[model samples]
Every structure is written in C-alpha cells, then in structure tokens.
Target: MSNRMRIGALLGASMAFAFSMAAHAAAPAGGLGATHYNLSSLKSDGHYDRFIVTWRPGSAERANPSLMRQSMGAALSRAGLVRATLSAQGMMQAPVQASYGRRLAIGADVLRTSRKLDRNEAAALMAQIASDPAVLHVAPDVLRHAVRDIAAPASLRPSAFKPSDTEFRQYQWDLKAPSGRATAFGDRNYGGAHVNAAWDLADGKGIVIAVLDTGITTHVDVNTKLAGAGYDFITDAFLSGRKNDGRIPGGWDPGDWTTGRPWQSMCTDEFNPPQPSSWHGTHVASTVGAERTNNGIGLAGIAYRARVLPIRVLGHCGGYDSDISDAIIWAAGGHVDGVPDNTHPAQVINLSLGGYGQCTADDPMGQAIALANKRGAVVVVAAGNDNDNAKYFSPASCPGTVTVAATGITSRRAYYSNYGRTVDLAAPGGGIYAGDRSSGEQVSDGFVWQAINSGATKPVADDSNYAGYAGTSQATPHVSGTVALMQAARLARGLKPLTPAAVLDILQRTAATPKVAPDHRIGAGILDAYAAVNMAINSGGTTSQATLLGNGVALSDLSGAKGSRTVYRIDVPEGAGKLSLRTSGGSGDVTLYVNRGTPATAEDYHCRSAHAGTSESVVLDHPAAGSWFVTVVGRTGYRGVSLVGKYLASR
Candidate 1:
C-alpha cells in the first residue's frame, strides 16, 4: 500500500464533528473518517438486532438519498430481507423482523430487526444485504463497550496501608516485582517495569496524554493535569442520556449506569448485570499524572508534571468504534469539523480500552492509529484482560501502537493478562490477593491502586479517594506514563521529538528480561522505565555508534527488526598478518562482515561472517594495509548482539 496516499486520505480535512452535522460540510459529518471497512463489526451488549446497509455507488440513492432509503425498504420488502436472513441462518422458525432508517454517512441505511437476534443470524442478514447489487457494504451495528469493568464488583476494598508525608503514596506494588517472592501486603513480586526510579529524571512537564474512556471525573488527585476541556465523542444523545447534546466539548464524566427493565432497557445487557459508570478514565489518568507529594494529597503519578487530554468514547450501554476512531484523530492535533483546534495536542495517547476484533488495514481503528502516528503521537494500547492472544484486539493489534501486557508484584505475567507475539511489553498489572482464612492466610492481592470517585453506583468525585483495579487496562497507563517521562527527558536534553517508532525502539531495547524464566509472549520483556529514560536521554538517539577498535576489541549495539549495520573502524599495524571477525551473544540471529578498505557503502563489503545460527565467523587469509571496517547485522528479528575482531600476527 502507498502509505503516502493512504495518509493523504485524511478524514481530518473532510469529516464533521459528528454525523448529524454532516450537512454543515466544511467536512463530511465526523462519522468514521477515512477508516473505511469492507465489513466492520462490533460487540454489542444488548444483542445484534440492527444492521446498516449502504446503497452502492452509482445507485439511484446516489442522486436522491431521501427517496432511495424509502425505495430500498419497499424493494427489500418485496425481496423479504428478514425471511432471507432467517432462512440463510437456519432460523426459519425464529421471530425476526426489519425496520429501515434514513441514509447513514457510510452511504448506508440502518435496518433494525424486531428483537435481538443471535450474532450468527445478524451475520447471516449482513451477508444477504451485501448480495444486493444496490448495496455498497453491510455490517452489524456492532456494540462496543468499555474495556474495563469486564467484571466490577458490587463493592471495592480500600487498602488499610497509609504512606509517609514526603509521599502520600499508596502501595504502588507495580513498581517492583521480585520474582518468586511476595510483598508485605501479600501481593506477589514479579516483573515490574521499575517506574519509581524513572520518575526522578522526568515528570512529563509539557506533554499531553489522552485517555479515551468513560471520561475523567473531578478527582483532586488529577485535577491539575487537565489538558483543556477535552471533547466528549459520544454523539448519541440517547446513549449519553443528555438529549440534544451531541459531541459537545468537555472532559467531564456524566455517569454510565443502567437499570434493566424492558421499558427502560438502556442498562440491560444479556451477558452482564447492572454496573456503575466505573470512573475508568479517572483511575487511568491518575496512574499517568496524579500529583504525588502534593502537600500530602493522595498519591503520585508516573508523570505528575504532564497533563492529560480526556476524551470520552465510552458512555452508557457502551460505545461504537466510529466515535472512538474520530476521537483518536482529533486528539492527535488532527482536524474534526465543529471541534475547535486542540490547544494541547498530545504527543502520546493511551487507549486502556479495546473491542474484540483484529485491526486490519481496512479497519477504522487502524486508520485512526495511522493518522495519529503520522502526526507524531505514540499510541499505547492494552493487550486486553482476556488471557488470549492480543492479536485479536483492535488498536492493540493495530501496527504503530505500543501494546502492553500485565505483570503482578511477583514480576510474572498476570493470570488474566492477554499474551501473544503482538504484545510489545509488560508492566505491573496488579495481582493482589486476599488471604484465605481456611488456607492459613495465604495472601493474594488481585488489583493495583489509584484514586477514584466516592460513589459506587455513579461517579461523584471526592477528595478522600484511593482504590485498586486490575486488568491490562491498568498495565497500559504504566507504559503511557513512562513514555511521557521519556519524552520529557528528551525535551529537557534538547533532543528532537521522538517519533512513535523511535519511542518503541528505545523502550524495547532497554527493557530487562527476567532472570527467572524468559517468556517470549511478553514482547522484549518487563519494562525498566529508568533504563528506558536513561537510554532516551543519554543515548542521543543513535542507531549505531562510531568506535576505535583494539587488536581484540569488541563492539556492540542492539539492532531491531530492520537491520542497521553497527560499524567500527580498526587500525592494523604494518606487521599485522591475518584478520578474523565474528558475532556472538544475542537473543536473535545475526551476522558479521568486514570490508578491506574505506568503502562508502555496506554493499562494498569484501568478506562476510556467513557461518549460520546466531554466531558468524570469517578470516582473511592475508592482511590489508588501510583502515578496516567491520559490522554486525541483525540477520533476522531485532536483538542485542556482540561483534568481536582479532588481528593475528604472522605465524
């Protein structure tokens, strides 16, 4: 794909703030911008009772959208879309009906079924809709919900521990996880990213990190980190419970609670019980920037000095990917008509929520991510708490994102933290447990701590707040906060802003793998924020280094998926006879090669260390006179490797 053309196809230049405003066209209504999908779907909590059908381009609907929706309903009636859908789904005996709505921005119309049909039946109807030559695309109005509260308990237990005055710090057990050991609070010690030390160097002064979840509450812990009134991307007034209020500009949480009565089915979900608004965004924002040591306030944040951009994508019931994608682009300083220019464009964005689906090239989430990356925003995503392969989740699976997994106090991958090749790194996702009285008080801490609102049923910000939550949702902010710290350090050092790719590279290269046992599923390894920031600040962004070699000196640098040659200059004495070079000590396979004279390019190499496996060796039968250059290359995936050189005297 021509990345240039795809990037140029930015919705920022053409989409309105929301679909209703599509007619006021400085841009198309800010529906799913540029995030076109041949067939995009969602995971609804209620049921799959609605399907959206778009009239194909060149169809009569192209000329008269109003009459077209009307005629299609008549045509589908004659064609019997409901019966066809039922029969095709082998639900011929099932009660199914259809009602059509007006034209949608995707050039489609909504077709709500009588009752919630099974997911298979909805897919079946969508298949039938696609076959109509007058249709461009068809997909379920898939339900999308908050990634948190997969299961929120009726009541939460606030820990009894209190911190000192210099630090009102709650037990941030995620900071250090000692392998195979347990903390005093009965939480396991495992692979933590070492965040405490990282905070000493940088506090994310000017960077803005956007949190796209329920929305932030007025919790004192993070009150000062607000990055203006971030937009509420929830376009549906009904879902937002505020009639006539569409995509307003504000970052406050209104609450997302539901009561399950058929007459008022807004809170009813076939799979889950009634739940509170979660205040998920507030909790996550605190992890990234709650003022620590604030005259004995609550607790400290990863980047207390950094500000947060609050964008609400999830509300009552759940949310749609269409709205979520729009918020992503807008947060990265991209344009969305009707939404004012973001004064605080975020350098980093944290998505602690995701829906169940792969982020393919045609997916809107992927497109949004691409736009964010193009605009210099590093997107960090949670790998999900499903304990399944992270590759199946949206933005997490999307390329150009830093996908993170969860590790507990014991420094091991959390039991519920999803794993796979797609995950980039792991951080402290709490595994705090309660002691089993029957089991002689075996301690287990099931969550991580941060400040939250006082109300359990609704979000009511209270100063006296501190609570714990678990999930990769918690792990993600850890990575995002450190990224802010890294960026802050970079700025302080007068270095150029780090691109998304550069940020990922430095974090991965500096990560420390556990000595206990290596788990490939956790990406490079557990995060070491201190080590990462150190590298980002002191390394000066050099991919390779210049070096002077001794007779037997060795040089090395960590190479990534893309092979960057680590070059070294060697001086040979007049009496030097033969030269030998090789590579060893690396997690990934690599090769070493040498050139006789000062060749301007890597292609001019005269001999190579082509021996196989990770280590390669080659010897020159005779010696050359001038300065010699030797290089090590990552033959495969990225890894840290060593290149050794030896000059043998005449034998």
Candidate 2:
C-alpha cells in the first residue's frame, strides 16, 4: 500500500518546544494596515491555511524554535475573530493550534494553522503576524497546481527523418515543424517547437536540466543513466506522501491524486473536481530528455542525451513557495541545510508550477531565482494557466526568469495561458479545443503528448504510458529542453556555458514568428529549437552582448538603471532610402546611438539622439546597408521604454 495521505489530513508537528524566551511583541494598534502583507494575492486565492514567515537575520525567531513558536502563537491569539472584508456572511478566526512546518533554505519558516481560513480571515491573521517587528515577511503558502489540463490525441502526417519512437509520426505533432498542414482535427499542426531539426545538431549531451515539479515516476522513455542525485524537497509528510516528515533522497512522485473526502474538501472548487495523479513531472522530464527515442518504443525528447535532475517540489494539494524556493537553490548547486549538496548542478531549471501572486524582488522565490541565475542556471517558468496577465503570478513574474507562454497547434496563444510582457517566448502547450480558442468543444490531438503512468491514484503495474495534456506547464519544458540542447551544442564547440541572460537573448532572438498574431502579449515569438541551437553553436558565449533585431514590431518595456547600456542590431536591406529608429513611452531619460556595420557606443556612433525622457529617435537617409547597431544608454533609471525600427522605401 502507498503512504499517500489525504490532502490537509496530516496532523501538525508536535509543539513540544519550551516557551520561556521573550518573543517579539505585536505592533501597536493601527500599524498593521501599513505593513506589506500581500493582501491582493490573499484576496485572490480566497482560501489559505498555512503561511510562510521570514524573520530578520539576527532575530531570535530565526535562531530559536521556542521563540519562533511563542511569537507566532501569540500573534495568532491576538488576531482574534473578525468578519470577512469581501463577504459579510463569512467569518474569520485565528487557529487555536498553531505549529511549525519546516525552515526553508532561504531562512523562511513555514507555519501551519489548525484549519483553512477564508482569504479575509487569513489576511487578518497575516496582519497580526506582520505586526511583529522581527517578522520580515509573511505570506500564505499558497498551493500551486500543475499548470496542465488533460485532453485526447490527434492525427498527423510524417515529418522529414521521423524518429523511430512509436508515437512520433502520428501523435507527437508538438515536436514537428510548422507545416501549416490541416490535421484530422480542425486546427493545423503548425505550433511545434521544431525540435526535430535541432536533434540533428545536438542531443543535449553534457547538459543537466532540473525539473522542479511533482517529480518523476518510473518511465521507460525517460533516461536515468546520467541522472543526478535527485531529492524530494517536499518537507510536509502529508504532501510528500512519505512516512517521514523531512526531505528525503530520490525525486519520486508518490502520486498527487486529490481524491475522496478530506482532499476533495480542501483542493476542489466549483469548476475543479478532485483530480487524479497527473504524473506531471514525468511528462515534463520526458519532454526535456526522454532517452528512449529512435528505439521504436515511445516518443522523442527535446534533449535525449542530457541528464534530467528530477527535484520534487509540488505534492498533494499543491506545493508551498518555501519548498519550491529551496528546491530552486538546491537544484542550481546552492547549499541547503540538511540536504546534501547537489553534485550535478543543472544548467537549466524548469519550474512548471506557480501560485497566485506578484513576485517581488524581495520575495523568497524571487531571490532564489536571482541566485540561481547568478549560479549560471537558466530558470524557465510557466506563465501560469490563469489565462490572465502573467505579471500577477509568482516566479512567472519574477525577475531573471525566462517565463514561457503556451501556444496551440495553430500557433495561437493557448486559451488558458497567462500572457503579458513578462513572458519571454511561446511553445507548443497544445490547444485542447477546435479553433484553439476559448469555449469550444474539446478535440483530439489538441494536447502535448508524452509519457505518463496508467494509475489514476498511484503507481500502477505499467509505467510506460503516453497521454496528452495542455498548459504552460507543458510549454515550459519545451524551452528548458531546448536550452539543454543549446548549452550542449555550445559546450561541444569548446565554448563556455551561456549565462542565463545570454540564453534568454539567444532564445528570443532566434524564436520563430507566430503564424497568427497572438490575442494577448505572449513573448518575442514561438521557440525555434534549430535556430536557437545554431545560434548557440556559433556565438562565442556572448549571446546577450549584442542581440539581433528586425522591423514591423517594437521591443516593449525595455528598462535599465542609470549608466546601463543595452545594444541591438538590425540589418538594413540594399537600396533602402531611410533607416528610422525611435524610442518612446515609459519614464526617465535615455540616449539612442546608431552606428553602421559595427556595435554602437556613446563615443563612436554615426548618429545619436539624447532626450530628457524616453522619447528619442535617429533617422539616417540613404543609410548604408549591412548591420546597424543601436544602443540605448540610460541617463536616469528608465522603464517601459519601447524601441521600434522601420526601413522606408527608396525614393
């Protein structure tokens, strides 16, 4: 029998610590409202039972469990009962029994309440907790689910040099190139990441990708030969579905099926019912590097030769940001307490799960991502499945992350994909409907197909199974896996690994333009694995130093602090009369420099435009052909700056 417990069914840890130390007292009355408690996210999730609290570095709460428990319990009692702000009929009460969950790698503590509370009640309790001067930050441990939704399969024609994997030709439309060919379903199979072409160049040798999700189960297609020493980062015993409470070795999915009474009561909503175990990590991991390709068995992986370091973060009823934050750091070779140091540091970290919240620079997950980027790991995150602006989602909106949006087979933004300027690019997340639009009947072959387990609730006899699921969750791995191939190709040429920023630049620069205009702002374009790998092989590990640009669209929301410089290059066609470059919108002062055939700098440029604010332009009549480099130098800290280029017809 499996050790899986129902969601929210596990009892809190023993509160046996002595409470003799003097804890930080609550703030004076009327000061609670002034604190930053993430009220917007709290109001959106609508239900929260557990909260994560980060204490000041030198505070007693960070050093002593007794002091931490005392301070938190006292704050809970002080909050008392209150009426819900959004609903008059709803009541909010503090938990009678409060307990410590686990300390995170980022030095945050997870605190659990006796039961779930409404958003307003949780807000009130959060206000009380934030009132303490020692408390640096406190936010709900909002549960983040797998961003994918299930669907059926579709028919597809053969691509050039099809893999021997049984499902490659017919069902794996996501891996093929955009043929614009009509499928058995209404939509054409044109939204693939074009991984088939990239396969001939690089198979992700010598690269490691970490999948931070529900973890990997047994799969024949997924390669474990070069696997790293993975870990299950889920600290909660109930969530881990293990007997022990603390983290354990081995990143195995013990099943995240939220079925039956208690789990149903906790995880279900009006539109959502109790879900079966998704085997999300398995499918995601396979997409990155399922090695059983060309063996006449399953399906092809984007990076078949690369190592996948499966790190379990999400579990039953979703995972906490605290667990996820630690997982991100650990996967990128950062040290975490108690957990062994990762011997195999991943070059790419894929986060296919996230919760409702804007990720601030100070947020634990945000800091963790920044650190991961500093460690040279490209962090790829899902743009979320909320079908709203990705800026409102954690990690997706986090700085230094390559947030990915979802596209259907027809290359349209998936109906359920979150889109915004935060998204870096789009991938085949599969549209589960007729027209790849919202509110249509579900169709076959509308989901990204990959390996999965047959069991509905837990691991079953057969593990080599394939199914289709759709979401930005599925789209994210396409990018992560492609990054592995790019890095592997770069390394094969004796070049140093591309930095996170460099990787993003290459990806955005080489991405394929969408066949149809996106309904919302997704990103630069659809991921082109071949172009990305080719660019990686050619560039000398300085991909972001000078990015390539084109006309017809503006690069929006460009921002930089004072004295920072960002450069781009656009090729002018022969016989062009004028090359017009413009920068407008947003705030603060900036200068634009244009140079022909070389990188532009302040001292050496053919033309320059300096404005007090963002409005700046440079026009060169009878402009010389070849590469024209445009540089943007910040006079003051600027944001939301849009840069556009246009080549006029010759007179």
Candidate 3:
C-alpha cells in the first residue's frame, strides 16, 4: 500500500445560507434595514415574497379567522403592495395582495406576497407588515440548505482493524482514539472523538435521534426498520418537488437538484452554481446510528442501536424557517395541527443545517427550540461552515442548543468551522489536509468516511455507496450520536434519562483536552466519548443549574504559583447590558480568559487579556448570557490577588 493515499474528494457541505453567495455582487441594502430579517444570508439576486408572522398571544389575529384576514389586508394596504395576486407568468400584478400560507407549530403563520421580492423590497415589505400591532415578529421566509459537504470522486483501500465493519479499518478514522504513534499512514490524528472506547459502555439502545435535513435515501448499511415513521415538511409546491402544497407522509429524498428553469433564475447565480441532490440526510443518519454496524458490510455508526427518525426539511434549493421550525417541534413530539403527532419522540435531535442570523427566544426558531427543550430533547446543531463566528448563525446561536464546532484529525479546529463564544464542543469534521498545516495537497485521512448514495442527480437504491465528507455537518452527528450513547447508558441502569443540561455538562466535563491549539475557541475541547459515556452511567439522576457568582462581589486574597490556573464561573442571564471582570491590587503577572457555556482556557476563550500585571481587565458590551467561566492563569508566582465581577442589567 502507498504511504500516501487519496480516498475521496471534498463534498460541499450544504449551508443554511449558501456560502457561495459571499462571492456575488453586493445584495441590495433595503431601506431602514431589518429588525427580524437576516439580509446577510440572501444572495445578491435572491428573491422571496413570503414572510412568517407570529401574532401576539392575546391578539385578535391569533384568535379569530376573520380578524386575521382583516389585519393582513390592512398591513398590505399600508405597504402599498395592493397587488396580492400573481400574473400567469408568475409576475406580480397590480392591487397588491397578501394571503395566509400555513400555520406553524410555534403559533406563527406564513404570509405570502403578490410575487417574489429582492432583498430591499422584501425588507421594506416585512417592515411594513411588522408595524402591525398584532404582529409580534415578522421576517422573510428564507431558504435553508443542508450543512453538507461537496462530493469528491475516489476509491477505498483495505485496512486491518477491529469491528466487523469492512470500512472500519481504513476509512473510519474518526471513530478511533487519538494516537501519536507513527505508521505507514503517517502520525495518527490526535483529534479523533474516541467513539470506539464508548462502545463498551453503550450503543444508544432505547433512544431515538431525529435528523432534520434533505431526507433519507436507501442504503444497505442503514436500517430504517427501527426508525420512526417520518414526515416531509416542505410546504411550497415548487420547492417541495412534489408539485403539491403542504407537507406529506414520508421523509424521502426525491432529489433536490437545481439545474434548470425558474429555480436557477431566482435561487442560483454566478457564485451559486447549479448542483445535484446531495444524499445529505442519509449520510447524517448513518453517522448517528447505522443499523448493520459490526455486521461486516460497510462502516460503523456512533450509536448503532439508537433509532434514527428522518424528518425532511430541505428540498429543491433549501427549506424555509417556517417549515424547519415546525419540524423541530414535531420531532420533539410537540403538537402541530394537520400533521399527526410524532409517536417516536427523539431523545436527541441533530440539526446539520443552519442559516446566517442571531436567534432569540421570541423568534420562530427560538420558540421552537424552547418547546423542544421543554419536551426533554437535546437539540444539537452544527456551528456552520462559513468560518465565521457561530453567534452569527441561527439555531447555533439559539439558546438551549448544544452548538458544536468541527475539528480535524489533529484535533485542531477545522479551517472552515465557525468559532466564537457560543460553541459548546468540538468533534471530527475532517480537515481535507493530512496535517493541521495549510498549503499542501489533500489526503484521504482528512475526510470522515460514511455511507452515501453514488447517484449525482437522484437515488440509486440498494447500492452500497460510501464517501468521505468534511464539514460541521459531519462533526455535528458525532456529538448527537454520543448523546444517544450517554442517554442510553443511563436508561440501561433503570434510571431516568439525563436532562439536556446534564448531557451538555457531562460532555463538556469529560471532553479530552485538545492535543494542539486550534486557531480559535472551538469549545471546551474535542469530545471524549468514553469519558462522557462513563460519566453518564455514574451520574446521579437529578440535574441542576450551575452556581452563579454574586454581582459586584469580590474574592479577596487569591494566590497561585507560576503556570497555575484558577477558574470561576458566573451566570449571566439573557439581556445583560455589560459584564466586567478585573484583577487588581495583586503582585503577579496573570492572564485572563473568559468564555460562555464552558470553562475558559488559553486554547478556547472568547475574550482574553494579558497586560503585564494583575491590574488587567476584560469587558464585554452586551455579552451573551449563560455560564461565563473566567480563568486566571499565573504567568509568574505572586500573592494577595483580588478578583471581582460586575454586571450592568439591561434597562
């Protein structure tokens, strides 16, 4: 065998907002900008005429059908969009019209305009509609695509490893423990999630994981027998590819190719190239829990015994937040009118999809997540492939979600993985580069191998197709699968499942320290599956919130030796105005590191200060609230240091 081998090509990870749009001409800056709309995710020429509106709880629009129609009509009239109907050519006609589309599970309604509007036009229209007193929130119904990878053509080689799965030896590098020993394949990656060690503790039995993406396809390595009877949530007739409006019965991928006609005219541009249907949902599902894992055929799954529930939310170009939000609630067993209730509620929900925007508890996505969390489902989301801060992405930024960033084989943050204060942890997302270093030819060890369809435009049933993919889309499943294992391990002991908060805490607490520093703060560290599973098995059944440091309180007379580190945590509630942490009157050179959700470290922190003495300060304006961990590292030995935390409540 050759010392260096190329396994497969890079698959484009489908983004909630197509990263390709960044290369296009500047999109129109709508008047007065937007309060709820995420214009940054739209393409220069992208068009949309639909808006999702959530009515105030006690508003007449939310209670009476007649009043709701009147309210919508008044808003359209004020916006000068009297042309509510479209011409035969699908063009906007005079006498602006607006109509109700569908009701969302989050108590929001989808509103369609006369025709598609560009960025500026959509913003103006949405703003006008939002001005209505009954409308609590209104934003364009932007499409969201799979956070999947682009496919590269290649062949697999033989290898020697344990487990009956044929691909486990050579291709499945992500499942094994990190190693430093050199071999013909080169130095082993120090970043593997260590899933193999977790297998001894649990295989995710009696747990259900729901994957929200492009939908599932036929693959021999994947067993859907234990899966829930899934549903398709795309509502547009053209986008659904079903030619019928409203959601359907099964979650099947009938190809989401955008190569021809109006789709290309409206959704695609020079930067956004036309492409084939990516078997994104299938790949994600396989990673979570492949049915025939150790049976000696293809690859292995993280939680092989966990039931996977496939819920289709992406189709054609992408999907709408309106549809995706509803799917989120339904996947967690929440009620959605018109659709039958989910019989197999997922213990964990994997969202390998995201869009550009910050989310809040009031937004459709946020509301849905709150419901999911209430139902005891841990929502795991990809940090995004844009290489930007995860805070700029939806769902990932949404509170209560376990936001995950990607890491390469070396445990370094994947070059394309989003980084910021919001990330929860890191997992194997594939680097495409053999080593962490950039500027080199790609190698096979950089990709995460899994089951996928070979068909470019459509499904090729029963074909044992597999490929190497890279993206936060791939990294997210690793965590979701591990969550299944942890949950199952607890259940096997005749104990109640761990709460979402407890699961996150255990995963963060047990994560392995990164072998090397990533360019940014990806999270607490690379996930340690074995440690996490073990901790889950041993933890008490009850879960509680972490302790909060007192506001304006000071810890006096603290001291540490050289290179020693001390950590303190503070709880910052949502809507905080300012957060300040400072060390003064101490005779030592120390560095300060702070991050939300997990303990702060030199390798992973959102804010840091190193200014010669103990009189250093770190201040954040409108910081995101959660558990903010502050670390004081002794650069040189000293004593009599005092640390104080001051917070300004939002007025």
Of the candidates shown, which would achieve the greatest lDDT relative to the real structure? Answer: 3
Ranking the candidates on lDDT from highest down gives 3, 2, 1
Q: Which residues of candidate 3, in runs, are more than 4 Å off?
A: 1-44, 83-95, 155-166, 182-184, 226-228, 260-266, 541-651
Over 4 Å off, model 1: 1-46, 49-121, 124-141, 149-170, 176-188, 224-228, 260-271, 291-294, 434-446, 515-520, 539-565, 568-651
How far is 51's C-alpha from truth in model 3 (Å)? 0.9
Write down the lDDT of every candidate, Cα atoms only: 0.63, 0.75, 0.76
- lDDT of each residue in 1-651, candidate 3, tens digit only: 112122322223334334534522343454214554444444454577777788888887887756766776787676666645565479756675667787888888887766666665565676777778777777667777777563433533344223345457667778888875442357476888889999999999999999998888887778776344899988887877776788888777777777766576756655457776677888888898954687767678899998899998988778888889999999999999999999899999999988665666767888899899989999999998887788767778888999999888788888878888899888998887768554365667777777777676678876566667888999999999999999999899987788787687667666666788778888777888888898778665222333356888998888987555678888887899999999998696677878888776544578887655689899999988788888876755758998888889877
What TM-score would each prediction reach against the true structure? Answer: 0.71, 0.76, 0.79
State each model's C-alpha RMSD to the native. Answer: 12.0, 11.2, 7.7
What would the per-residue lDDT of candidate 1 be over residues 1-651, giving only the tens digit for each residue? 000000000000111123212212211221223232233233322246656555656787556746554554554454444353444356654445556543333334556666675543444455555555676655455546655522223243333334333223335556643444555455445555677778778889878888888787775546634634698888767667677656887877777666433213654533445655567777888887754544455566787788888888877766666677778888898877657877788898988877555665445566678888999999998887666677656667888899998775555676667788789888777653342111222132445666666654455644445566767888889889999999999898787777787687667666666544434387766778887787677643233455667778776665555234466777766667787776676667555557766522223457765433467787776677668777655434656666677887755
CA lDDT, candidate 1, residue 355: 54
TM-score attained by model 3:
0.79
